[model samples]
Target chain A: MDILQALANGFEVALQPVNLLLVFVGCLVGTLIGVLPGIGPISGVALLVPLTFALKLTPESAIILLAGIYYGAMYGGSTTSILLNIPGETSSVVTTLDGNQMARQGRAGAALAISAWGSFIAGTLSVLALMLLGPLLAQWAIRFGPAEYFALMVFGFSTLSALAGKNMAKALLATLFGLLLSTVGQDPQSGMSRFTFGLLQLEDGMDFLVVAIGLFAVSEVLMILQDKAPPAVQATVGRVYLSLKEFTFSLLTILRSSILGFVIGVLPGAGASIASFVAYTVEKRLLGSRARFGQGDIRGVAAPESANNAAAGGAMIPLLTLGLPGSGTTAIMLGALVSLGVTPGPQMFQQHPNVVWGLIASMYVGNAMLLLLNLPLVGLFVRLLAVPSWFLIPAVLAVSFIGVYAVNNNPFDLLLMTVFGLVGYVMRRLDFPLAPVLLGLVLGYLMEVNLRRAMAISNGDVGFLFSSPIAIVLWVLAGLSLFAPTLLSRFVKRGALGDDEI
Target chain B: MSNPTHRTDRIVGVLLLLLSIAYGWTASRFEVGMLSDPVGPKPFPYLIAICTAVASLWLILRPDPDPQWPPVSFWLPLGLVLGSLVAYAYLLVPLGFIVVTTLEMALLAVLFGARWWQGLAAGLAFSLVVYFLFTAGLNVPLPAGKIWGLGR
Candidate 1:
């Protein structure tokens, strides 16, 4: 079916009572989590995945809820960055540079209002792009073969490794660690056992949900424990209603950032963090001497917020088309999909058109839902921010434990969950990237299955991995991605970190 | 904080290097006699071990490192939290849900630095809410004890 017809069908599914309610609940939960310091959409989705799993959701309904959280959290994250001077994650860091400054200058309401509107604009635009671009990419990706798919996975892994780490060696090590973790279960082909340490639990390997929640959520809790910043008190809280003039003035900045975000988002390794940075720098360069730029500029808040939201849409490109996730959030989405027995790749668009198109269609409706929910209810959400951290901690822990238990009606999973959580906490304390671990857990089985299949096909030929042109190209790119970090850091430092600043 | 952070990183890096070597040694013990394929399951583990060792070495060799160790106060609380979790895992089956979870939550709250009564009350309330939500509302099963008829 054409994109229009697919979208129409998606709307039919999305508008149902259950799905719409789920979308709304997902958005609210997402925003709340996004507003929380240190927690991002990645952990937000991971922590919630068990709930959805236990809730017995249809795959379509599940995707709608998860995707809604993915995008809606971006919008909520902008709020905290603007008002509290604390960005929830790296993506919102740029928003804080101007946003918090604006708050200090008494334009908090205006900045908040414009950010919400800018998000709405970029979000709506990206949905239209998703409707058009996703189908096109799906059609083109239909030509891929096993060798091509293997190369694509390699490319995906390389891109993420390079993007994730501070240097090439670190990225390589991270990627290698991921590949190694995949070897911890019974060999898919040879039936040879690996790394199981004689434990029966290791036979099934690690559950991605366990790894994801433990690494992201548990690690996050540990990180939060290290914070010296006091729990945020409401600061000059007010309604977030934009003036017509204010909206019009920031419209151009929003447009520029949206396009910039979309482009950056489409790249394999570049995520919202990069998109926001690029958008902010470009806005500064374009504004030149006319604007304050970082000193409480309205355009400053608008640009990054719009770019980040648009980038969320852009991040989906590689995932839907190539079965590769570009950011941590998308990685969790990938995990969620895998849990539902869906393997994402070029063929996924053809095989699961409803999931792809329905998710795309829902983004449009979800954005509208967030914009409506965020405006008048801004004060209400900010008030929620006032709930004691002590209370929130226990509540969240309880819910997470309950969700895991309900999944299998087993306390063993809950124990496993806690163990992983402790492991996650330790990893975070050491500054290790949690993303690699999640990537490892999810992709380990697939990599093994494919490697075994390829080996069997080639009949013990070592050169089969490099025999294909696609494989050769991918290997070369992977090699380059190992070095890309050092080169990119130099250019990024000049524009992003400033020459003199840390 | 900075000195401790760097010191800890160096210690952790060295430990990881040692761990990777052990992993490599263990991996080498997996026998694949005359396997037709050039690579096998063992190859992946050895490769990972090598990479881990190399990365750990690199981290150790760096002169200046992030000079921020998490506070001992923070870490101590986390340790208690983890200890209680382990305790809960072992005790839950024997003692039942309410008794074990109530103890777990209470202990965790105190470890998180809550005062005694406050921690006890909070833990009890949290456990009760979970019990009701899971068992009553969701109709999911929970362990019932002989005494409470619900927590075991």
Candidate 2:
């Protein structure tokens, strides 16, 4: 009863005309970002963080807008994959396999329709799951002490590092690198400078936004320069409607993949890309020679399309409930949340239920808006694909620079951003994961604070970290995350690995 | 970078190791001022440095196969693009938001293959649009031009 009452109040906040309009605009821009190749939700939201602050919207409205963009992007991401055989983003990479196959056979209409429908169904289902599950998780997390929090974050970093980049070593290095960056400012507890290198600007610590926009958005511009532009492709959506038989065929696939994806997404480090690939593989094995997986099967489009959207919804559970961001985009969202003057954690649900539920309720409305928008306007987004890399890439960079400058009006941050951009570009080429560095940076301060707090509480007894059963469980999970991938990786293609860290 | 060998990994490994050592060395010297908290700020940095050292040592011992870098020619233009950003940083106050942003975008357009005048027009249009959005809609202040003695 309390849950329904809270969600209803959330609906009240979300339905305000201004909030509705923000969500609509967020969805529209999000789809554009998704339809474009070489840019993803991380860059899109990273560019918006400062703008959102400058706009002076309430934290609830800001979150609603950003959340709209996050899922709306998942919707638009499938368009290029189905039409051009180019995934709009990494999460939709699997869609390219079967999505393009359908397009080539003149069934692009059915593929697009089915994907929209599946995304709609799974998105709604996963939000429902989040609604039911989020409060429960928060309640459990409310009992955490500093020791439990420390152990839990260690678990998060371990899983993320092990599963993220080209190899565990590179990923761990990125994680350590991020932790080092987080320690640059004066230590809050001791008031001692850790690694300021004597720079006065660093007293407040490295701003995550400057680094993120620089690394993800600015580097994307430099990256486009290295490769020639995508050649113009000839493709069309014939009818944009799925036959009843096609609908029935993919319905079961959508439901199954949505469930599978939600569970994968709820894990600490696992995200949409993994859920989609694993769902596709599982469907392939389930069909056992009856299903055509890689060559434009309807179920192929259904599996990843729904799974990724559902995973996006599922990924939010940890972020809202536990203040843990499992993937890169969510980490950026976490940054947005922090900037909005909202601390994300167990208390968020109780202290700012309007922000919490408003965001949740907005996703439902946003998903509906996306289904309507995608059904008719797939052509509009596809036309946007013609935007030359020369034009779009520069525009994106301009936004990154301007937005970072707007945040503090500091040119030094701009220089710092450029440095990170080059660093990000090189790291990508070397196959070092970028997300863990972000994850480490975002989570590092909290991890250090909690570890120090636990140590203080325990009077420097190292055994206190392992003292609690919850802490023990978290440590064990951390170990499993490091080892489980090597054991379970045989099921996935090597191509489907690594880059999913996004 | 030109040769395309495992040495990229080794070089990166050495750099990381140096960073680890540098971090560790600096962290070890922090004077314990508080003596209030049971464990001061030193342990976390030590943990991070040690982790980096271990990871970098592994990378050094067992380097991965070579990853091919983009063509060497990429450096000049890449530098130009990155340079434009840094230049825009210092120049924004002096040259103004409109002038610096226009130049940055135009440089990007021209570098990626556009006519200079077209790039200029496009850059001006985009910069003006952002200018209007910020000043008119959000009521936010942006530097006009310090040398011109414009809006403070």
Candidate 3:
């Protein structure tokens, strides 16, 4: 079927009463979590995944709800970035540059309004693009063999080596660390014991939940402890809605950023962070003399906010079509999909159209809901900040632990979680990226099994891996991406604008 | 202390490299069956070991500029947390829900930097609340301690 027909079918599924209700609730919860300091969509979704099992909903409904939370949280993340300098996710770090400046200058209300509208504009447009591209990519990926899949996973891993660390060597080490961690359980092919050290609990391998929650959520709590109190933020909110002139001025910036962000997001490993950075640069370049960009430029607030949301949409393309995740959050989402018994490559479109389209359609509905809910309910969301951290942190940590335990009613997972948390804390202190570890844990086994299967099928012919033109192209691209950072840095330095300007 | 941070990185890298070797040796213990293909179950772990070794070598040879790391004092609480988790694992099945949870929360609260008085009080209160919520409210079966008659 054509993309339009599929979307229409998707709308039919999404517009169902229960599905729509789930989408609304997911958005509401996502925004609340995003507005809270230190929690992102991953935490929100992780906290909620168990609830879905309790509800016993269909796979399609579960994904729609989860995806709604994923993107809805992105919208809410900009709220704190604008009002306070604290970003809920790294994706919003660029938003804080001009957003908090606007807030301090008494245009806090305007900054929030522009951010919401820009999110809406970018989100809606990106969904439209997703509608068009998802089907094409799915159809194209249908021809992939196991060798191609292995090469694709290799491409995904190499991106970490290319972009994840201060230098290629460090990134490669981080990737190795992730791969080793991925090996901590029973070997898939040999049924051989590895790294388990005779502990019965290690037989099944490390749970992604244990690793993810410990690394992202628990370690974050430890980091928060290192600080005395969060930065003080006071906002005099005025005119919660955008004025006509303000809307006109920001709309152009939003459009430009959305296009730029979508393009960057489509490329594996270039996600919201890079998109936001590029959007900011472009907005500044256009603003030139009028650029109060680093200060309180309203366009400054709009650009990154729009770009990041668009990039989030762009990330779904590779995940859904190619079974490749462009960012950490998407990697978790892919894990969630796999756990739900859904293989997220081209075949998913054929086998589970409802799940794919329902997710896409929910994105449209979710963006609208976020814009509407955030406007009048901004005060209510901000009130969450006033809750004492004593109650908030413990309750959140307990709930996360409960969620982990609920999976198997096993306390061993809890022990594993705490250990991973400490390891995560140490890794963070040393400036290592946590995302690569996750990507490795989720993809490592799959890459290994596929490579082995492909080799076995070829009867030990080494040339079989490179025989495929697609595999050769991907390997070449991976090689080039390894050097991309150094080249880009040199090019930027040699240009007229200094590092600060870019 | 010229590159104090690099020292930690180098040490950690070496340790991780050792871990990779250990993992590879473990993989080798399993009779690695070749599926008539160059790649097998052991191939990925071996690749990881190789990459880790190379990276660790590079880190030791050309370490990045070091920065200050957190002091050992901060790790003190980790002991308490770990102890609490271990106790919970073993005692949850034996000691009744109320006793185990109360003790665990109390210790955790103290470890989280709360004052002793406040930690004890808050911990007891929250533990009771959770006990009631999970057991009385939700009706899920909970661990009953040696004093089974009192829990029942």
Candidate 4:
């Protein structure tokens, strides 16, 4: 089917009353969660997944809701970062640099407005890119053999571990732990139990939702408890509308950052946080020493906001096309899709056209909804910051508990969630990146399955893994990604030496 | 007092090393067919075990110089919250969703420094709303306590 016709059908599905309502609810909930400190897109989506299952919505509708929350949280994240200087997640950290500055300067209104507009424009643009790129990538990926798939999965893991956090060893250990956890069930090929430890619940392996809620939601609650109180927000939001001159001034920065963010987003493990940072830095470099970047510059707000939203959209492309989630948020979305019985990969377009297209259409709608909601409702959202953490924290935990219990009505899952939550807390305290672990768990089974399948097809010859050009390319890419940080640091050090000699 | 935080990395590394050994040993015990496919499930586990072992060793040898452990005040609240969650997990099915959830939420709120009465009220309101939302709206069959019949 042509893209236009597919989109038209998607609109038909997305515009249905129920799906449209879901989109609105998703955006509202996403914005609320995003506006709240410590509850990021990952936790927002994780908390909502079981709710979607309970709603019994069709796969497309369920995904639309969850995806709506994903990007909606991106939009909402800037609100807190701007107002209170506390980023809702790492993705919004750059926003805090200038967002809070703008708030302090009494231009909070302008910053918030520009952020919403920039995000909407960039989000819509990236969706356009996704609409164009997603199908092509999926079509191209259909030719991949198991070996290629395995290599690509490895590339995803390598890039994730490399960029997940500062400590490569910790990131690697987290990934290994996730892989170990993924191994704890009956082996799919042989029907032999590997690590069930003689428990009935363990036979099915850990539910992704359970681990996600534990790691993101529960851990977040625990972490929030450690804080004495939430940060105070400025009461008077100056003005909601941006001046025409200011909008025009930021136009180019938004455009540049959107594209940069989209490219960064498409790269595995490089998410909105990196995209926003790169965009902000690039814009700063473009302005050279004349930049007033950290001092409430409107362009600072616009660039990161635009870039992060664009990156969010860009992150979806790989997930939709290759079934490889680049970040923790996308990993949760991948888990949601898998639980819905929708396998996202090269064949996703052919097998689940409505779901693929409906999600795309909903992104457009959800972006528009966010823009509409955030602009006029900016005051309302800012007020949400006043909701006491004492009340909010437990409320979120209650929701997570009920959400997890609702999944299978299994108490054991809750116990598992608690265990993982504790583990997540410790990992966070230790500065281990949590995202890579989710990525590992999400990809572990697939990686193992593809590896064994590739070996099976190759009749036990390991050389077959390198026989395919695509596989070889992917392996090389993985290796390069793993070494890229070290290589770049070395190059920079050498450049410094050359400068010193001069 | 050479950076008290540095000790954490060493401790974590030693613990991880021990974990990897146990993991690898257990992985080795997984039943594998002698002639069954070349790359069985055991290979993946063993691979992870080795990676973990190596990474832990690296962490032990080159511990980060400036790890910032949470302050002493953080533990009491952290422990309280964690303990409540574990208790919630165990009591959820037995005491029922509403009863245990309300109590757990209240405890958590208090742990976060809420007043006792305020925490109890907020927890009660929140848990009741959630209970109704899930049980009635979403068709999730939350447990009612055999002791009180508060939920269905």
- Computed on alpha carbons, the lDDT of every model, listed in order, comes to 0.74, 0.87, 0.77, 0.86
lDDT of 2 by residue, A216-273 (tens): 8877777778886576665787779988999998899999999988987877567888
Using DockQ as the yardstick, the better of models 1 and 4 is: 4
Please provide, for model 3 over A235-309, each residue's C-alpha lDDT reduced to its tens digit, 9 standing for 90 to 100: 556677779999998888999999998987877666787788889988898889987888888899899999989
* Superposed model 3: Cα runs more than 4 Å off: A231-235, A487-502, B1-5, B33-39, B71-73, B86-88, B95-152
Q: What's the C-alpha lDDT at position B17 in model 4?
A: 92
List, residue by residue over A329-434, the lDDT tens digit for candidate 4: 8998888889889988999999999999999999999999999888999788888788888888888888888778877788888889988899998888888989
lDDT of each residue in B53-83, candidate 1, tens digit only: 8878776765235546666677676776666
Highest lDDT: give the candidate number.
2
Q: How would the candidate models be sorted by lDDT, starting from the highest?
A: 2, 4, 3, 1
| Candidate 4 CAPRI category | medium
Candidate 4: regions farther than 4 A off:
A231-234, A494-502, B1-5, B33-36, B149-152
RMSD of each: 3.4, 2.6, 3.2, 2.8
lDDT of 4 at B99: 83
Q: Let me know the TM-score candidate 3 reaches against the reference structure.
A: 0.91
TM-score of 2: 0.96
Q: Which of candidates 2 and 4 is the stronger one according to DockQ?
A: 2
Candidate 1's C-alpha runs over 4 A off are: A407-415, A487-502, B1-11, B31-40, B61-64, B111-114, B139-152
